[model samples]
Target chain A: MSVSDTHRTIDAIWRIESAKLIAVLTRIVRDIGLAEDLAHDALVIALEQWSQNGIPNNPGAWLMTTAKRRAIDLIRRNKLRDQKYSEVARNTDLYTEDDMDHNLDGEIGDDLLRLIFMTCHPVLPQEGRVALTLRLLCGLTTDEIARSFLAAEATIAQRIVRAKRTLRDRDIPFEVPAGEELSDRLSAVLEVIYLMFNEGYSATSGNQWIRPLICQEALRLGRVLAEIVPYEPEVHGLVALMEIQSSRFRTRVNSRGEPVLLMDQNRAEWDQLLIRRGLKALDRSQKLGRPFGPYSLQAAISACHAKAPTAPETDWIRIAALYEALSRVLPSPIVDLNRAVAVSMAFGPDFGLQIVDMLGNESSLKGYHLLPSVRGDLLVKLGRFDEARKEFEHAASMTRNERERELLLKRAAECNSAH
Target chain B: MRFMFIVKATGYSEAGGNYNQKYTDAMIAYKKSLAGAGVLVSAEALHPSSTGIRIMYPSDSEKPEILVGPFLADQELIAEYTLIDVDSEADALNWALRMPVPTGCGEFKIEVRKLKKNLGFLRYSGTCALEADLKDQLSMLKNF
Candidate 1:
């Protein structure tokens, strides 16, 4: 392969292996920021050498070895800080590629989990938490993070930098917390993971409807969590949610990256592997012998879709009931908003509209784009074209996703033509 | 030192806040899992920015002006906050590191500044503009 091809190969490997690489490196180096920097340094080396050497057979292992060597060199260079050097060097040899590939299962999952907890730690702001996770776990570039936010490159750059500095200055631990602190921190961790999954599921502003890489990484991490914390029902719940939701990736967009609503998607396009995995995870969550938590419930709802052979066969009433249970477990305007959609699906537009009207004055839903979008759908069903047109326009104006905006506007035009 | 993991809300982050049955269940399950493991302190998703405003530094340095709705920064978007008390900065940061991005739409920035020591300042200085400013800007602000 030519040097360019080699570089491309390395890039692909990095995309696939960076999270695991960082996860393992963090365990050895005991620094989330440093682990990432080391991983990048390995990337820099691969970029320079892989072109000449050809892509290594075991690319992740190669990267791990190269990073470990660089880490040793870094420590030797700063021998003046010999004690610090020894602290890192002592564990350096312990991590052979196979050791990481096989044995250090506890550490690998824990490191990733710890990294998640650290990034989602209460010390850093939430934006910082999300950015750090995307960068570290998703292996997304700063530019990708910026694009994800519809934000400027420099702004994301600063956020990542500031977040790292904050973590360092505060001396945040690289291990998962225990006791009550564990649940608190774990919640933050789960929140970040689910958010990552949702973004990939329905990108807010990207040209693409699905960012497969993001979803894949989140799912991978969630699966790892499920394994390491087997008793934790929510881990299974999250994995289940990702699996079922991700099953729709194939049907989510057209070949040209245009949006495809659920009602319109070809059910055959859904990934069977993901559906099976999701269903299995949901079953595991239920077997934990506790009331189904939110994620398991959602997974159950998605299961409704997965089980259906066609759109018309979707069990809207069951889903509505599930949403009701969800609301009881966790109440929010957004949950209410979703329940309204189910109500519409199961009963009629009027039934859904009543629920939506009840939520009209909700403090949280005031600026939510979906609020108007749903209202427009309900209005269209009521034969209120003028009102629906206005609602669709409002939704279009409110949405940040260019694709979503287009769809809403197109709907608005339909509403206008009907009048 | 106690640290607040501020959950910053961007437009993208808020998009997934109100999800259908599946999404909400996923979030609640995750929250409950966190609760089971005993790590969650307190958390809440915030309302969309349309319900809020951005108060910027006024032309006159002594005053501030509030702009209506859409508080996302032109360059940086911050969504919400979470307050956590940990044994060390590393502990706080490790936890913050795991926090899911809001809706996974945007990034999260955790500002790990130590909480300021109250130090009887309120008692000593019964009334002051700085204190008033803190109250208005930071004091009464609850973590989401």
Candidate 2:
């Protein structure tokens, strides 16, 4: 292969193996920042050597061995600097090459999980956690994470640097939390992953409709998480939710880049393979014999739509029930608003209007555009066209997204013409 | 991006001979790993070409030509395919490289091809448009 081709191959191998390499390194060195540096050193060496010697037969193992050697060297050099280094040096001597290989194969899953927990520790700010998780666990460059989230590269770089420092200063243990702490930490980890997925699934404010790469990265992380923590229902639930939502990417927007309502999306164009994987994940979550969590509930709601042959054939009653359950578990006005939509479809406009009108007094949803947008749809269904037009106009004014505002305004115009 | 790993048919596959137990187990393990990683979209093994048919549209004639298979050239045929959605072509290639080669089969090859997106939109546009129209009418009726 050419030099550039070799570089590309090494890049791919690095993306696949870096997280595992760093995870194992962190376990050995007991410092995330140091682990990452050691992994990078190994990568740099591979780039230099692989181009000349050709790629190794097992690139991952090669990278691991190289990083471990770097870890041992760093400890040896710093042996007098700190007691921790001396201890790590002593531990390192117990492992020969064969033991290192066995440890990598056997302990990688647990080490990776620990790395995720450390990155997503609740002690750090949410943005810090997100930046660090993508940087360390997802093998994303700081520039890529910045571009994906529409942040300044320097800001992302600073965020990651600070996050790593905080991880070191806080002296977070490089192990999964036990018992009561486990659930909270795991949720924190899941939240960071889901937040990454949402930021990609929907551009909250920008002209861009979707940042697919971010969603793909998030989904990949979730899948990996599910594999490592197979018994965790919520992990599978989150994966299911992301997979099902991702399946709708194609029909979620028009060719002109306007927002397309879920009901209006072309069901035939939905990715069946993703839908199948999503449903399988949901099944796995259910089969774990635990009560459904918020993500699983949402996945169930999406699955209702996925299973429908057409919009009119959708099981809105079941969806309404799911939303009711979701509202109970999650207790957000947003869930209630979604429940109203399902109720309107399952029952009638009047019943939905009652619930939505009750929500109008909600303090949390005061400036939420979707509230008015959904209210407008129910009003239109009730033949209250003038009121519907005003609601749509209000929703249009409240929305920040250019495409969403255009869609709401179009709905308002349609209501005007209907009257 | 989505990629299709086209597992090209071998002489043994074309002859409809079953894979050895070892190869079958290895293939299963490979697919399990793919699914575990969440990159796997779909995987399917095709029946031998003898069970299939090929259709050809001739430019000169109003009628299309149909050929019954037991097609020639086993190497050109696909015996199985696995679809995956990954971040890049490199990632797809990495996954393709990990696919288990059938033991005892001569000259195993898996071709990786990136699938073009939005092709389905063109194919289903007419039906989707009709569905939208039908939905409009139904909503109108409900409103009245």
Candidate 3:
């Protein structure tokens, strides 16, 4: 292979392997910030030498070995500074390659769980937690994250810096919280994963409707978490949610990559493997015998779709009921908005409009483009073209996604023609 | 000497609104380039002053004055910190001069100064205990 090809191969390897590398490194280093820095140092070395040397047969092993060596170097340098840094570094060196290989077999799940918990630690603010997790665990760039949130790159960049510094400054322990703290931290972990999945499902700002790489990463992480904390009902719930949602990935976009709305998608295109995984996860969630949390309830709703042979065969009433349960457990304006759509499908547009109208005064939905988008769809169904047109136009104006904006504007034009 | 740049103080309104992805990508590239050159130590964008209060020590008194504001002014916010492993301020500025144009907005500034160890004052000052106590209080307040 040419030098550029080697560079490309290394880049691809990093994208695929960085999370596991960091997870394993953090296990050894016990400092997330340092683990990430060491990972990057490995990446830099790969970028420089891989071109001439060609890609290694075991690229992951190469990266891991390089990162560990870099970690040792960093520690040795720090050893010059203070007794404390030296002592920590000395303790770290006790684990050799044999120890690492052995530890890897035992600690893959535990280490990933630890990394997730560390990223979502309560000390960092919510945005910081999400941004940092995406950067480290999902291998997303600051630009990718900013685009995902429709946020400024500078803003995401700043959030990440502060997040790392905050973690370092506070000396937050790199481990999963146990006991009561376990569930609370687990919820944060699940939230971060779901947040990642959601951004991928409907990219907040980009031209594309979905970012499959992000969704895949989230699903992989969720699966890892489920393995690490097999008994945590919520972990299973989250995995179930992601699996079912991901089943529709192929059907969600058309040949041209334009979004095909849920109702318009081809049922045949859904991945049966993902659906089966999702159903199994849902069964696992229920087997735990806990009341269905928000994710599990959402999964149950998705299972309704997975069971259906076609859109017309979908059990709308069950979906509506599940949404109601979701609302009770995690009553947010977005859930209510979604419930309105289900209610409209199950009952009638008039009934759905009533619930949606109740959300009209919700401050949270004031700028949340989806509210107006759903309202427009319902209005169009009710033959309220002028109002629907206005709603679609409003939604189109508010959305940052270029493709979504185009679709919304097209819908608005359709309403105009109908009128 | 490792120099840190603090963002300047200015109105959040004057800082303008949140930028778009294109602007943000540019900033990331800028930071990456700086990292490549080994000049950029660290950079962070703070939450607008609206999210939290800002407190500052008055030169005349030990107690700091609180203000509800962000780092809005170019002079107030320390935009970039250029840290040179080699000797002094001159070396730090030499690295800072290579930084690309400000990523998204108004005039940006860079400050070149030595990181204060303050070991002597830390040893002699009676206030060190109080400072430690304050840090403990702040740390306690962090999560909630």
- Residue A234 of model 1 has an lDDT of 78
| Chain A accuracy as TM-score for every candidate | 0.75, 0.90, 0.75
lDDT of candidate 2 over A142-241, digit per residue (tens): 8898888776565567567667777888898899999998998898898888878876766523346554677899999999999999999999999998
Candidate 3: stretches off by over 4 Å: A27-30, A43-66, A69-73, A76-81, A93-99, A141-156, A204-212, A254-258, A333-419, B1-144
By DockQ, the candidates rank as 3, 1, 2
lDDT by residue for model 3 (A273-299), tens: 999999999999999999999788878
DockQ of each: 0.02, 0.01, 0.02
Which one wins by DockQ: 2 or 3?
A: 3
Write model 2 residue lDDT over B1-144, tens digit each, in one string: 568999898878888998898889999999877665545667899999999999989999888899999998556799999977554578888988988887767788899898976121112211232232223323422443
Q: Estimate each model's TM-score.
A: 0.59, 0.69, 0.61
- What shift in Å separates residue B134 of candidate 1 from its native position after superposition? 39
lDDT of 2 at B12: 86
Better of 1 and 3 by TM-score: 3
How does chain B of model 2 score on TM-score?
0.78
Best by DockQ: 3
